[model samples]
Target chain A: MKRYNEKDTVEMRQVYADTLLELATLDPKVVVLEADLSSAITTTKIKNQLKDRYVNVGIMEAEMIGAAAGLAVAGFKPFIHTFANFATRRVYDQVFLSLAYAKLDAVILGSDAGVTAEHNGGTHMPFEDLSLMRIIPEVTVYEASDATMLAALLKQGYKQPGLTYIRTIRKQAITLYDTSELFETGSKTLRKGTDAAILASGIMVAEALAAAEELAAQDIDVSVVDMYQIKPIDEDAVMEAAETGAIVTAENHNVIGGLGSAVAEVLAEKKPTKMYRIGIREKFGQVGTADWLKQDYGLTKIDIVKAVKHLCSE
Target chain B: MAVHQVKDLSLFAQEIRYYTLKQFVTMGFGHYGGSLSVVETLAVLYGKHLNSTPENKTDPERDYFVLSKGHAGPALYATLFLRGFIAKEWLQTLNQNNTRLPSHPDRNLTPGVDMTTGSLGQGISAATGIALGNRLARRDNWTYVIVGDGELNEGQVWEAVQMASHNKLDHLMVFVDDNKMQLDGPTKDISEPHDYVEKFKSFGCYSKRVDGKSTEAIDQAIEWGKKNKGKPTVIVLDTIKGQGVHVIEAMSNNHHLRPDEETTKKIMRECEALGERIGVST
Candidate 1:
């Protein structure tokens, strides 16, 4: 077992920029598009290096998507970036029709995932981005759990065909995977037990690990699995966890159509295990720190600990 | 540029009108007005300008055409059929169940559709992106798109326009089908579109308005646009909704007509008249 580290390493945005620069430098067909948020995602640092391959479409998310479709038509693989809310909710029809419906190849990186919007508040926070993306046919949706995972997913997203949407946070996250770790399997189990399984993603993976450690102190043995790819979810790992007879899903998004819902759908059809979903429920976000918001939304380690205990006991 | 070439293009325009009406009549009811409005432009494009044929239509390096006002797909499909990009039999399948030819253009389903567009104001943006991509790749392939005047109401059209002009995508050309009618009513009654030429010029395009029903004027405007460098071009096409058919043109609401017995008869008569002009049978 790889012990969890609480220390934050490199910012996810930096990893995104570095990986994009590496990919763009290697492939002429790779194009990067930003909707006036180049500085926000640190893509502006590579502007001179990428030259014509980098395009900033100036506050037009819909136009960016349309252009990406066009670029895809002309044999260019486009990587488009914008805030999660703007990328999904603001220009959903464009993403749906121009990119996905047109069968064009493009990867959309939606930074500042739910709760991470922090001071940007409810208007910028997207609890439904996963829901919006998951509904689109053949669109591979992923939530990056850490810096190395973000880099790995970005590289994979570049080579894959069809439409892909990756939800990520722009700031530093708790270090999980090392640089050598690969995310090709879509998930990784950090801890193992038979009492129950704590299935989590993104920021919640760290919390789930912490909860598992705390539960271990009390002699309640539970497992923690990082389910990164939300759409083509790791159903095999899910069923494996379902063997424990108890499961608790945790995420930073709304419970309605995100990780919790995805896992519940698989379990409902396959195994029918006892489960509890811990995430934002029937609420909007506001101006607050990410830590405070996670506590308010019941998305902390304690919340996962409570849900795991309740589900296991029941 | 020759007199006989313009005459041949004029006959091609009539052929496009003929096939467009054939598809609409086959579908029972379709976007006849908007479809008819862009016949001459489609003829001019397929017959003379576009560097694409049935064999090379799938080639990525070939010139691209995106019908932004995708309700006018029948016009494009008719042009593609005449150009041999699609079989004549596929013309009967427009909007039918499990048909490749939907009500709008679909790139994957239809043989010659460069972009799928039904939701208005999106095709133009895709066209601009294609143009930019071609420019970056140093390909001489040109990207052309058509947008309805009513479709201009979507802010995304302007966003694409701004990006196209900013990028100086000289190989890109836009055609605004100023048919002056929308689904609800006249465009003027719905939204006051002040002046397309001036608006496009302000957005950094070399724009010109021409008689949309005339193949010669459209061909000449495209020539002028091709000569202009350092910017994309917008050709504002001044045309009637049900262009080339007097009875349909005179109708107050011909945008999407569910014709009565008499109206269907009249439309079929006009179709026969067009086929006669083009030396083809309806």
Candidate 2:
């Protein structure tokens, strides 16, 4: 097995633009909307390529969401793009009422997810987008772990036929899946073991795999899964992981209601296994690189390793 | 193909207002003032300008209506009920338990309701979305949205205003229910930025001012708006808090009212007297 450093990565933003252009090519109804950040993946590229598919709704995020819903009503598969901060918290009501409650076909792309906001600091970081989007009934909330997952989710989002929120990181994503593989909305297990199961989403999937590999070197067995879809969480996979009787959930979000809460919701009723969450412990993010932010917030592979070990011991 | 005559539209306006009051009375209290203010506008749009019928509820090319001032749902429900999109039986069920009609318009629950809008300032943006979608599809569809003057205070409304104009949603017509009143009191007291006509124009909209109480004026303004090309039109409908009913219009606060027996009877008396004088033979 080979360990990945910074070099083995692709920009999720460029992958997003290409995936969106592919979707637009496949279905002319696929349209993208951005709030002044036309340079972001789905906005400028789609505008340049499709001619009439990209809409720059200026800096108005709520209008971007509502207009996306309106586009949904008019038979266009609309994808709205903005930072996760404005995408979830600022325009939440529009997403809730105009998109979800109305049953519209729209994809909300909240980029620069979680601690990846980096130099943009706490105001730009969105650790609670998953929580807010999941509360809306039947909305498909997903976090793309790498370029491959980002590309897959972008295609699925175009034809989801309901409100979907896709959280993406703009910068580095350590490569996880081959470009040839196809994906749908569910969890995927990359590694298996008998001792403990590690559930992770978004950036934490890579971290979980790293933690599992480290544990394997010490003769400790642990499984890693990419819980990509958070709303309709893969319950069967969670149950399978629970058979190990110890679980560790990791994500780049608040431990209170992010992927931790989602996994807890499943295990609390179905399996009731010993669980630990490796994520930001109720703390807002600050300016730092993804690596520094991971260490600062205790979301590194080391943290996942510690949590899984603790769960196994208990 | 004779046009739906002016007297017929005027009569429909009276019917909309009457049913609006009846529903409010049944619900014991509701947002009646704004509902009353937009009846004539609704009558004109639904009766004359719209290409929708009960037989063609899902007609893709038909004009769409969005109630941005969604507390005025009773008026719209009345118009839709009278227009046969809803059964007359659901007329009295306006905010009752398990009723088909909710306080705000929901496209999922109600037929002929183009967009679900309760949260204010969002429906206008939905209309912009619909207009933009139609533009992208190169389809001949129109969206008529009614927004409150008070709703314009919300910054989100301005965002849609900017975007709709920037995209040149020429088929989107917005009616600013300039009812001068909000929940607290006069809009001037709550948020004092008037002259919506100038505001929409400055936002690059084809803007005009119309007397909202008059069906003919609103109808004519809509006609003029369709002819003015390359921009969305905003009809800043100059209206009192309550129109057509002297008693309601005279109330110190009618935005949402809990009319005591005396006030309710007085409203009924005034409404009937005015209806009779105007030959609205109810």
Candidate 3:
């Protein structure tokens, strides 16, 4: 059993900045492009350290994606950063035609995923970013769960080709893995049980683990799997969890076209199972604290626990 | 420039215009206005200025060209054919099923196209990035781009203009195909594009306006842009919507025309006359 840590480690934004700086230091081809969000993502270090290779496009997300495509054409690996909504919804056409349709190689880190936008409210929140990225042909999409996973995916996305989109929260995340852990597989099984399985991603992974712990005391053991990569999702992991007969999916996004929908699609085609999805159901975000918004949107561990209990009874 | 060189370039421009009309005739309908508007600029660049060739186009240090106004792909394809980058037979396959030459420029499909562009306002930003990348590598490669006057309505173009000027992309030369028209109507009626020279000058470029039909004036502006360093250059091409052909140029709605039988015959006659003047048979 992989034990979950209650302690909060480094912030995901700092890890992203440090990893990018390290990558740019070693390889001259690595370049960083920010749409005037260096302070937001803690990448001012990169701006200061690698001044020659860093580009601040100044609040223009469309130009940022286009510039990244050109840099990729010139044989330079570009890592673009912006808010999740700006990265996808604001410049969907640019990302689709210039980067994905043109078959260019670049990595995009879309921070402030979903309710993590907090007081920035509905306009900044991106509930459909994963959905938007998945529809683009051959685009790799991942939602980073913790600091370790965020760092690992950033390193991996650097070597991987084509368009890679990593959705993450910029704040501190709960410690999930050690420095020695490698994330070659898109998913990981942290807990095992027989009654049902809880598949989750992003901020919901921690809630799913807590929900499983609560369900154990109620004499219903549930498996918990962390499904980080939404596109090219780990089907083997999904199938293995299906052996439990009943499944529950939790996410920080809308129930449509996200983690829940991805798992359900695999199950409906390969092996049909009784499943329940716990997420925001067609609602926009509002100005509130992260904890208040998560609770208001039914994204806490209690909702996951209730969902699993309902599935087990049915 | 030598008189013989000017005559050769003029002949090359005529040949490009001939091939452009032939592609539209093959397709039966296409962007006749914008495609014909940029033929002379394409001739001057491919014939005299650009260091890119069929042999060295893949080289990182070679000069690059991006068709920001990508509806004019036929003109670029015709220019590439004349430069030996593509075969003459491919000109007939424009917009055909699974053809390499799509209605818009695609870098992966076309051998000589350096950037894939169709959606307006993106190619200029990409061109800026290419110029910045070459400068980062310490390569003296120049990056050239052609943007439509109407395409400037996209805010991304101004964003790229600000970026190129801020970065001091001295090797980047942008040519505005100021044809005074877009798909709907005249650009002035659609959106008041006041003065391109003043607009580009305010955006921190070494801006100039010239007769787009005069290849010699365009050649001189490019030479002057190369000499003026520490910022990007913008050459505003004063051209007609359907240049080089009187019948098409006279049409009010020549942006994308599906010619009638009589009009098609007139266009073919113009192509024949241009081909004869360039010492080629149509």
Give per-model TM-scores: 0.98, 0.96, 0.98
Model 1 off-target regions past 4 Å?
B1-7
Can you rank all candidates by lDDT, best first? Answer: 1, 3, 2
TM-score (C-alpha) between model 3 and the true structure = 0.98
Cα lDDT of model 1 by residue, B1-282, tens digit: 111133488889888899999998988999989999999899898888888777787777788999999999988889888877789999999999999888899999988889999999899999999999999999877899999999999999999999999999999999999999898998989989999999999999999999998999999999998898999999999999999988889998888878988989998998998888888875
Candidate 2, residues B1-282, lDDT tens digits: the string is 222434578888887887787788778888878999999999998888877777666866677789998889999998888788999789889889999899999999999988999999999999999999888888877888999988988888999989989988999999999988888888899988767788889999999898888888988998999897899999998888888888888987898888999988887776676567556654
Task: Write down the DockQ of candidate 2.
Answer: 0.84
- Model 3 chain B TM at 0.97
Error of 3 at B240 (Å): 0.6
TM-score, candidate 2, is: 0.96
What are the lDDT figures for the candidates, one per model?
A: 0.92, 0.86, 0.91
Query: In Å, what is the interface RMSD of model 3?
Result: 0.6
Please report how far candidate 2 places residue A256 from its true position, in Å. 1.7
Write model 3 residue lDDT over B1-282, tens digit each, in one string.
111133478888998999999999999999999999999999899888888888888999899899999999999999999888899999999999999999999999999999999999999989988998998899988999999999999999999999999999999999999999999999999999988899989989899999999999999999999998899999999999999999999999899989999999999999999988988886
Interface RMSD of each: 0.5, 0.6, 0.6
